[model samples]
Structure formats: structure tokens, C-alpha cells
Target: MSNPNSNFPLTLKQCRVIREIMKKGTEKEASSSLNLSQSSVSRALSQAEQALQVDIFTRGWSGAEPTSAGEVVISSCNSILQAISDTERQLQSNVTTLLKLKTYVEWRHLLIIEAVVKVGSASVAAQTLGMTQPAVSKTLKEIENMVQQPLFSRARRGLIPQTAAKQLASLFLRISPVAQSLQQSLQSLPNELTGRLSVGMLSFSCQDIVPIAFASIFKQHSGIRLQAMQGPYHMLANALRQGEIDCFLGLMRKGPIHPELIELPLLPAQYALIARADHPIHNDAKTLNDLVNERWIVARHGTPIRDYFESLFHSIDNKPPIQALEMLTFASSEELVIHSDAIALLFYDDWNINKLTPRLKQIPIPLPKPECTIGITLHRERQSTIIQTFIEELKLTIIDKLKTQ
Candidate 1:
């Protein structure tokens, strides 16, 4: 069974052949180690190189050696294999069993297991996978036999995943993104870049950099499709972890973050309290205490800006304003503040301040400037060319914007 939309360009056997070549440093040694004939190993390497559109190995009298591109591909293969090995260990399986599992497993098997686990019904999974119910059931049974474990249990609602099934499905979910990115990178030509990139945005702070960077990317690479997903930091972070989005742009959080994600700092962020130019509080309020009782518009809870807003009052030994409106959108917050007496805490960059000027003015109260960073968050293992290009554009945009300000 083959899917045209499958993200993995290479088969399991091809990956295994590549891995053995990497470890043995020669096709002959690799074939011997893997118990495969020399012709079979050569064919696997040739097919893998052709599929990826890159020569993974350089052949000579000594043996086959990996090229720079081959190194990257091998690293990705190692990660996928490591994930499988980890899952095997978690299930109390031995090395021999792990090797057998790797040999017998195909990408479709992983996809089927993920589908069945996600939908919890064979019929539904069949429909999702464009297969009949019997086919789905039979494939799942084959997978269970291979693993030597019952992956699911019957229930009135649907099939419930057992511990082994859950672990196996998790392995697929975690490695799928890495494998997809690897394939995209290796298969794409530099001048003809093509792929779909999903970026998650946290609130409006990302507006300053994301739009301009995306525009530059679109102008240069029309073949690439860019999509933006917006939500709070936690939701976006979860989506990034689950591989729903490739990367996120927004204020970086303080404290320990997910181990599987990496945060690259682009610039420092400063927050300011602002009010309408004609508001009475602008003239009467000399300190934060003076505006404590006035209506306020703040970011939604669990956001970095909101945390900073609350901490401002906490530092002064006072509760935050009792009368306040919590908002997530910059437009809504700006409109509410402009039409009413409500004040807001917002990004205080020169670009933002200039945009809000003549209508809204920063409150004169002195505030502490904490160390806050704004940047891109991505999967730790992801090193796709498209993602790198977008990040470069973001950095350039930030530098240019700062220079103008």
C-alpha cells in the first residue's frame, strides 16, 4: 500500500541500509552486517539517493563515505531509529526484538496505527485512510502480531488503545514531523523551493515581524504555501510539540520550557501602560497607584503580557485593578481603550508607539523593564530549509525595523 501524500520519501529498508552504511562506512561492510547481499545494499542506496535527489554517499576504493547532505539525512534516520528503540525499551523489548520490529515495520503500518489510535474505530479509520473496514482491521491485526502484543481492546464506544498501542502511536506522532521535514529538505531544489509551512502566532506582538517576513518569503518563493495559526502561548506551544505547526512567533516565556522545543531569541521586548490621548487619567495619574481604580484592558490570563501586568501591581503591594476587561486581540484592545476610559498594557517598541501615537499615549508612570525576549519557537529536531529561510527573513526584518526606529 502506497500513499502519494506520504511524507517519508524513503522506505524502512532504505533507511536501514543507510544506517548500516553510516555505521560501517562502506557498502560491503554494511551488507555483511545487515545480512544482505552486496547488490541489494547497492540498490537500496541508489534508490534512496534517487528518491532524495541527493547523492548520500561517495564511492571509492576504500568504501562509501557520506557527503555533507548525507550526514544530515543520516542524522534524521538516526533520530527516527532512536525513537523506535526508545519505544521498544519502554515496552520491555530487547535489542533483537527491536531490530526485528524495525525490519518488519513499514511507514504505512505506523500511519495505520496512528489513525486507529486517533479515531478509536476501525471503520472510521478506514474511511480516513481511504481503505475498507476489513482492510483496516486486517492490517491492524498484522501489526499486533508483529509487535506480539494486543494493541487495542474492544469497547462499546470504540477500540481503546492498550499501553503498547499508545506507545507505538506516540512514536509515530513524534517522528513524523522530523521525517517529513528531512524529506522536504533533501528533495527540494534550492531555486525551486516548495512546501507548506504552518506558523503559530501568539497574540499581536508577532505582528511586527511575522507579516513582513512572510511577505518577503512569498515574494521570493511563490511555490511555498504559508499558513498562520493564532492563539495564546500555551495552546500554540502544545500545537508546536504535537507537530501541528512548524514554528511560532511571539514573546518568549520565562522559566523552563518543553524539552523538545527550542527558542531562538530575536529581540528584547518592553511593555508600557497606555491610555487615550484625551483621557483624564493621563494628566491626573502620576503613579500606578493613582490609576489602580480606573478601568483597564489587559491581555488574557496565562499570557506573558498579562503576567507582567499582574506582576506590576504585585511589586507595589497592591491588587490589580478590579474593573478590567481581558482581551487577546490587539485591535479589540486598542479600540476599547480609544473609545472608553480603559487603559491597556501593550508592546512599547518604537514602531508600535508611533503607530498608536496622536490617539493613544504612554502613561507617564515609571515601570520596571524586565528581561523579556521575543523570537521563534520550533521543534528541536527540525532543520528544514524553508523554516531556516523564514527565520533569516525574520532576523533581517527585525534589524531593519530597529534601524528605522
Candidate 2:
């Protein structure tokens, strides 16, 4: 067995001594509990504190008191000792079978087992595995069939591991060492972390161009997985708040974004009035004032588009034309602009990128020349490792898009 003092090769025993001293108070009390000499305890603690490069305790006339560093060490020691005890117990029970099982299975199955140990609920394990409960059950059943023994037992709330699972857990007791070794061996690998990211984009932005760019990125970083959803800005905002999405990709002309969200500036997209080629306003609405009398198809209130459009019109005329429709989907809105006499607001870059210019004409109306604040946002509290990575990839993709533009 490797010595805890040496394996950590730094501070575990020192931390253990400090924690014991804090719990017992005074050298005599700690020495008796740890079955060590008072001098040994004192020396070990001093050596540990010195090795860790921190003072862990304050000696008082009455007893020893834990300093801030001592308290921190105590917390760490508790976790370390618990893990060590668990490891010891597991190894005493099973090690050979586990080594064989781990060699045969993929790492993902091991990850699922770890999740099961953490959650103690098969249903929750299923969700974390991104699988149905039936699928999780079937997988477990297959494992049992392969071993010819029961691995878990059904309980009132969740499933509990049986003797077979206990044996597996014992085998898994060696996981940290094996995992550490595996991780170290793979450390020099040059691959993006593999995971799915769900992003919400403004309707106009998702018009084939953006997703196509992301697909190219995925091809390059094959480890990266992508999932995208699109709707009006408000719908995306609501989804962000509810933690249903990872990031919001769009303009932010609206006043006061939610305090909970973090918005990062990307590219500058500009506004343009788009109408069907046959629409009368395409030729008539040449200036800002001319749009006052023209009927418009604006995205509903609370959307970033509506905010920017309203503000730009308000700068010229006190009243803007009422929206003929409050459509949400880009398809519906695009169709409205394509088949109707009504003029709709669009981001010029997006319209140009999507080949939408064929179906719609940019009315030469000079509005406030508001540039779309194309940015990305997500609820500040909801950032995960995968989400942050996706945001970085998105920014790179957007920058590349802007360079070509």
C-alpha cells in the first residue's frame, strides 16, 4: 500500500494532523485519539503546515485553535480520508474482476456507473445519460445477462446496487488511479471535447447561412456536437431564463437586457426594410418620413428587432406605423414579406447571406441607420463547460464570417 503521506507527496498527512488537532484541542488530546506521541503529532503538523506553505493553527494557553488555513485543511482532509476509506473497503472486496470489466467496456459506460453512484436514481441516471428509462433498464439488463447475476435491486424511490454492484463498486474503487493514468496518457491529444450544445438564434440569423457555417466548424472539430433552435428574440430570452438553451445569438438593441444574462458583442449587422419585389413600398418608401404612412410587419414587442425598429422610427416621427402582424417564425415572417404588400424589417447582412434578396427588395428608405448589435447571451448562472466551449466556437465562426464580409 502506498503511504498517504508519500502518495500525496505534499500535504495530506499534515492536513490530517491539523484536522485532528482542531477536533481534539491541545497536543495531549490529539495524541491520545490518533494513538501517536504528543511530540510526533506536533512535529507532523508543523512539517505539514511548512510543506503546504501555510500556517494551519494558532497555539493558545487553553488549547490549539484552527486558523483559516487550518479550517480549509480540515475540510480537505475530511474529503480525502473518506475517499481513502472508501477506496480501501472497495479494494478489500473486489479488484481483479473490476480490472477485467473496465478493460472490456468503453469509458462512457464507466461514466454512467459513476453517475448512478452519485445520483442513486436510475431515472435520473437515464436523463443524465440522455437515454430513456426503458433504455437504461435494457442496458442494465444486458450487463446482468453478460455477468449472469443481478447488479441492482429496485427500491421505492430508486434502484440499489446488489452484491454484484457492490463488487463492481469495489472494482471501481481503483477507478481514480486508472482514470488518472488514462487521462495523463491522453493529455497530449489535440481534439475538441465532445458534447452537444443547444443555442437559440434570432429567426433571420438562422436562415441557412449561420447553421451552414457551424456545420463546417463541426466538420473540422469532429468531437464537437451541435444543436440549434431559432425563434424571435423574446422567445429565445425566455428559453435562456428557463435554462432550456445554452446561448442566445442575436442583436441587442433593446434597452436593458435581463440583469441575469451575459451579452458579448460579436459583429455589427445593420437594419434594412425588406419587401416583396412586387410591393409598391419597395419603390415608394425612399426616405424615413415615407415609412410613417406605410403599413409594416414588425416582430412583436419585447423582441430586440421591435425595440430597435421602434426607436429608429421614434427618432424621426413621434408615432410609427402599427404592425400589421406579430409573427414569430422566420418562415412565417419571410412569407408575409414575400407574399404581401406589407414591408418588414430585416438585417441586411442576413438577407444578403441567405439569398433572400431574390424574394425581397431592400426599400431605399434611409431610417436611423441603426446597426444590429449582433451578440451572444446566456443566463450568467447557467454556464457549463460545454456551453462556454460552444460560445467560443460561435465567436470564432462569426469573426470568420465578418472577415469575408
Candidate 3:
């Protein structure tokens, strides 16, 4: 393998530096973590910016933030460097030497550095590298010794990769395509295009959208084995971030708009107050306020539907009544609302799709009509080709399902 740090040391180091700066989100923090004098860090960054012919950081008196161009470059580099590590591990295991290059120290360090970013700590990184913590530290020390400069900061907590790491991060991008192709060639190619995909949906969604016909469309790619996971929306979002599942299908709520996740709107839906035909409040209430003080059976707090109701109540000078019941499942929500005085805040489209009983009526309320948009989402950086294909199949299914309705 060609060393990414040889002729391109400056560029590589700059990329690493930018990653640190971006991660720290400030120059002082970046400089401190990089273990470099502020002036040295600034000079190296300046030279790298000139070399790459792009301004990688937006320098202000306060600190530096990654420029738009820098963000793109860093992202590309991160992916490439990860691919290189996977390639190296495969090659070393197989003892194949098609490419020879010096700077093996740098390559090895790059692997650890990437591991730290991926696993989020030295201990986790060590486990991933199949080495003990001390050995990982020693390897890191060797890299700093060879470079004749510290590339990471020692902390009471753990090692912090710096700007030098970011710069090297960028250099790996240039060489990754070759490494990826080799790795792909070396791995026993799967016959019939097989890949395992785990898909998650809200309980209501599973009951509604994910019927036999929906499963059949996804099964069109026999090589793609699809496993369905059902859970509450928040649980599924947590799973998506933790890599338990590849994608999430549900209403988008305002939470941390994780940079790692990308959401695609599938269809628009609206919210309504649903209650049983036999319920006292259904016949008694004419407006939102009349039902405000009444008992409510809602999806647990933090869901999009719950948030909508909360916002609706707040807008009309009322607080949501103490939740007499919390139903994370659509069946529970539908059953409780239809059988008792409990008012249900639910998505109109989902209610229709699930075909709730005729006893349940959607009570109109004069709040800003909040649309519960159903959408598809997946981790932005971790999506596999199979996941993308399944998502497309899912989208087609939804489109057809909605059209038929």
C-alpha cells in the first residue's frame, strides 16, 4: 500500500488537524488536543489550505470552524480512511503483498486513530484492534516519536486525536478507492447478491404499513434477507444510532437532528383528537379547550404526536392533563380512546391506514393543523447498498399503498 503520509504529509496532517478542530469546534481546543503550539497548528493549517487550494477552516478571533468545503473534504476522507483500515486488516490476515510501501507506522497509526473515532474511546478502540490498552498507547507513542511531534493529547480521560490526525485523514481519501476495490475483490463475493438487513418500524406501522404485500415487495430481492423489528419511535431512533437497525420508518419528531441520520419524507399526515362514539367527552366537547382538562390516552411523551398535542395545549393557554394513560402502541391507543373518556391524539393517515373501528371518531380541534409526515430514515454515514435497495422497495410499497387508499 502506498503511504498516504509520504509526499502528502502536509495534506494528510492538515486533514487530521481539521478533523480535530471540527470535533473540538474551536482553535484553542483543537490546538490543546493536538499538543501543538497554537502558532505551529495555525501555520500547518495555513500551508495545508494553500496546498489543497481550499480554505479548510473559517478562522475568526474566537477560534476556527470547518468551512463548507472543509466539511465535505473531511467527510470523504473519513470514509476513505475507514476503508483503508478494513483493507489493511484483510491483507494482513491473508498475508498478501500486492502493494509495497514505506510509512507502515503511519498506516498502522491511521488504523488506531480511525478506530478511536469509530469506537469513541481508547478501550473500545483497543478491543477493536485486538490489542491491549497499553499496547495501543505504545503504538500511538511510536507514531508520535516517528513524526517527531505529538499528534494526540494526553488526558485524564483518554487520548484525543488532533489536527494532525485530521490532515492525515484527508490524505487517506486520495488512496482509498484502490484499497476498496482490492478489498472487494479479495472478499469471497456473495452469490445471488445476498445481504442481511434489519428494518424497524413503530408498532402501529407494523400493523398497518408492513403487511404481507409490503414484505413481498422487499422480498423481491431474494438475496436481501429482511428482518422486521417493531418498537416505539424513540426506541427505534436509539437503535438506529446504536447500529442495531439500518433504518427507521415513522413520524419525524424534533430531537437531535443527528448528522449521522438522513430522513426522507414519504407522505404527509395530519393529527386529530380521536375518541369512542360512546365516550362522554366525544358528545360533550365542541373545541380543543373543552377536552383539555379531561383524561387523555396519548403516546408517551417525546413522540411526534405527543409533542403536537403538547404544543397544541400550550398554544391555547392550557397544560396537558396528567396522562391517565400512556400508550406507545397504536392498538392500545385505539382501544383506550374508543372504550373510555380518554382522548387520543393520533395521526389521521395512520388511523385511516390501520382502519380503526367505526366507534372511534376523529374530533376536529382548532389548533395549527400539525401534519404527521410519515418518512424513511437511515444513518447517513453507515448505509449499505442493500439498505438503500430495501429503502427504495419500501418507498415504492408506500407509494402504491397510499395510491390504492
Q: Rate the local accuracy (lDDT) of all candidates.
A: 0.79, 0.62, 0.62
Per-residue CA lDDT of model 2 for 1-405, tens digit only, reads: 112123332343444566678788887898887777989888988777665555566543235655444544565566545554554455435433442231123333444555576677778987876767776666666555444566677788777877666655554455434333322333333456544456787756544445755676577665444557777766777777765666867666554357898787766677777888888776666677777776678777877677777887788866766645777666787788888777788665543545555777778767675567677787878777777666566666766655664
Instruction: Count clashing residue pairs in model 3.
Output: 14
Instruction: Candidate 2: give its CA RMSD in angstroms.
Output: 18.9
lDDT of 1 by residue, 28-48 (tens): 899999899999999998988
Regions of candidate 1 where Cα sits further than 4 Å from its true position: 1-191
lDDT of 2 at 322: 66
lDDT of 3 by residue, 201-277 (tens): 86544356655534664456553445676777667777778766778777765543677788877667777777886
Q: List the candidate 2 regions with Cα displacement exceeding 4 Å.
A: 1-192, 220-225, 232-235, 254-256, 316-318, 350-356, 381-385, 399-405
Off by over 4 Å in 3: 1-191, 203-206, 212-214, 232-234, 350-355
> TM-score for every candidate vs. truth?
0.54, 0.48, 0.50
Q: Is candidate 2 or candidate 3 better by TM-score?
A: 3
Q: The CA-based lDDT of model 2 is what?
A: 0.62
Ranking of all predicted structures according to TM-score, beginning with the best and ending with the worst? 1, 3, 2
| Cand. 3 Cα-lDDT | 0.62
Candidate 1 — worst ten consecutive residues by lDDT sum? Answer: 92-101
